[model samples]
Target: MKSFIFRQFEIRQSAEVFRVGTDGVLLGALADIRNARKVLEVGTGTGVISLMLAQRNPNAAFLGLEINQEAVQLTRLNFVNSPFHSRLKNIHQDFKSFSTQEKFDAIVTNPPYFEVSGSGKDKIARQTIELNFRELISKSSEFISEQGVFSVIIPAEAGNEFIKTAEEYHLFLIRKINIKGIENSKVKRLVLEFSLTGKALDESEFIIEKSPRQYSDQYLELTKAFHVFKG
Candidate 1:
C-alpha cells in the first residue's frame, strides 16, 4: 500500500486518482481560514487539503469534491479514519457540474494544470479536457460567499493566467506566495488567495531547497507542523 504518514493524519495513496504532492499540501496549509465556518476543496484527490484545513480549524466543517469515483471513495476512507472525521465529507462530482445551494466561506484547490498533448498520447492528461483556467475562476466566483476566500496553487505561468481571468470575474488577489524548488531556480509555483474586494496584496517568496536534498528553513517551517518528511 502506498501511504504517507503526517503529523496528524495518514493518507492512503494507492487508490487515489491524483497523488498527494507539495502543491496540495502547500495550498492546504497556507490558505486563509481564520473565520471560516464552511470550507470546500475542489478536486480533493486524497482529501489531504481538507484534512489539513480541518486540523487547522477545528470549528470548521469541510466538504471535498472529486470527479473521479475512486478518488472520492479514497477521500471518504481517509476522512473517516481521521481525527476530524465527524466534520468532513466527500462528494463524487465534477466542480463544474456540482450544484450546491450552500456557498462555502473558504474554498481551496490545487487544480489540475497539465496541458493535454494534442497528439492524444496521454489518456490521463485528457481527463481534465473539460476544465480550464477560466472555468476555475468563473465557478469559484459563483460558488463562494461574499466575504469568502478562495485559495489555489498552480504553475507560475498558469497562475498568471488565472489571476488575469479572476480579475474579470472580480475575484481580487489578496495574497500571493511564489515558490521556487531551489534557492536560485526560477519561480515554479504560486499559492494565491482571493476575495471579492480589492485589498493590499500580501506578497511573499519561498524556496524549498538550499541545495540538493537540503530543505530551506522557510519551507521546513511552513510544512513542519503537518509533514514529517522535511528533507
Candidate 2:
C-alpha cells in the first residue's frame, strides 16, 4: 500500500486508484473553502483533496462522490483513517447522474482534463472519457448555492474554452491561479473558481519550483501546513 504522509494526516493509495499527485495537492491547498459550511468534491481519488480541505476548514463538512468503484473504496479507507474522518464521507456515485436538493457552499474537483485517446490503465482518471468539461460545469451549477463557488484545475490551454462553457451555465469566473512548473516558465495549469454572481476577477501566478528539483518559496509557504518535506 503506497501512502503519502502529511503533517496532520496520511493518505493510503493504490494502483487501481489515482494516486497522490501535484494537481490534487495544488487544488487542495488553493481552493477557497474557508467560508464554506458544506463542501462537495467531485471525482474524489484516494480522498486526498477533501482531506486537505477538511484540515484547512474545521467548520466544513465534506461529501465526496466518485464514479470509480475502486477509487470510492480507496477514498473511504483513507478518509476513515484520517483525523478528520467525522467530517468526511465518501460515496460511490457518478457525478453526472448525482442529484441533491441540498446546495453546497463549495464544490471542488481536480477533474480529468485530457481528451480520450489511448487505453491506458489510468484512462478514466486522466482522460475525459467519462466526464467532460460541459457536463461537469452544468452539474456543478445546479448544486452550488447562490454564494457558493465551483473550483477546478485544468490545463492552461483549455482555460478559454472552459470559461466560455461555464458562462453558458451562468457561472462567472471569480478567481484564477496561473500555475507554472518552474520560475520564468509558461503557465502550465490554471486553477479556476466560478460563482453564480460575477465579481472582479482575482488572478495570480504560482510557481512550483525555483530551480530543478527545488521547491519555490511560494509553493512551500502555501503548502507548509500540509506537506512534510524531507531534510
Candidate 3:
C-alpha cells in the first residue's frame, strides 16, 4: 500500500483499492480555485483531492461524492482526525444518481480510468465508475455555475477525448498541463481545467523528474505547500 501522510490527514491506498497517485497531486495543486467560493468533487476516492483543495482554499466549502462505502468511511475517519475535519462533507452517494439541486462554483475529479476490458492491477481505480467520457462532460456541465471551472486528471488519450467531449457540451478548455516522468518519457497524464469559452486556452507541460532520481524543481515547488519535502 502507498500512503500519503499529512499533518491533519492520511490516505492509505492499496493496489486492490483505488490508490492515490501523482496525477491527483498534479490536478489538485494546479487546479484554479482562486475565485471559487464553493466546490464539488466527484468520485472522491480516498478524499485526497478534496483535502488538498480544503488546504489550499480555506474559505471554500467543499462537497465530495463517493460511492465506495469503505472509502467514504475511511475518508470520514481521516477527516475527523484532521484539524480541518469540520470543513469537509463526504457524501456516500453515486455521482450518477446524485443531484446536488444547486450549481457549484467548481467541480473536480480524478475519476476511474479503466475500460470495461483491460488488464491492470488497479482496474477499479483506473476506470470510469458509470459515467463515460461523454457522460461525465455532459452531466458535469449541468452542475457547473456560469463561468465556473471544472478540473480533472485523466489518461493522455482521454485528455483529447475530454476536450472533444467538452466541446460538444459547450465547456471550453481554460488551461492544461501535460505530465511526464522524464525528459524522454512519453506523456502519460494531463491536468486540465475548463470554463465556458473556447478562446485562449493556456497550454503547458511539466516533467516530474529532471534526472534518474531527483525531482524537478517545478514539481517540488507546486506541491511544496502540502508535501513535507522541501529542497
Best by TM-score: 2
lDDT of 1 at 159: 79
After superposition, candidate 3 runs with Cα above 4 Å error? 1-3, 13-16, 116-122
**Local accuracy by lDDT, each model:** 0.85, 0.95, 0.80
At residue 114, give the lDDT of candidate 2: 82
Worst 10 residues of 1 by lDDT: 119-128
Answer with 2 or 3, whichever has the higher lDDT: 2
lDDT of 1 by residue, 1-231 (tens): 679898999999863266777787888788999999999888878889999999899999998888777778889999999999999999887788878789889989887677765554323323456567788789988889999999998889877778988999999999999999999899999999999988999999989889988888888888887988734
- Backbone steric clashes in candidate 2, count: 0
Best by lDDT: 2
lDDT, candidate 3, residue 152?
88
Model 2 scores a TM of: 0.98
List, residue by residue over 1-231, the lDDT tens digit for candidate 3.
Answer: 657786456777644556667877787788888788889998777778888888888888888887777777777766666667878889888777777588888899887777775576555456665667777788888999887899988888878788888988989998988889888899988887898756687889899999988888888888887787734
State model 3's lDDT.
Answer: 0.80
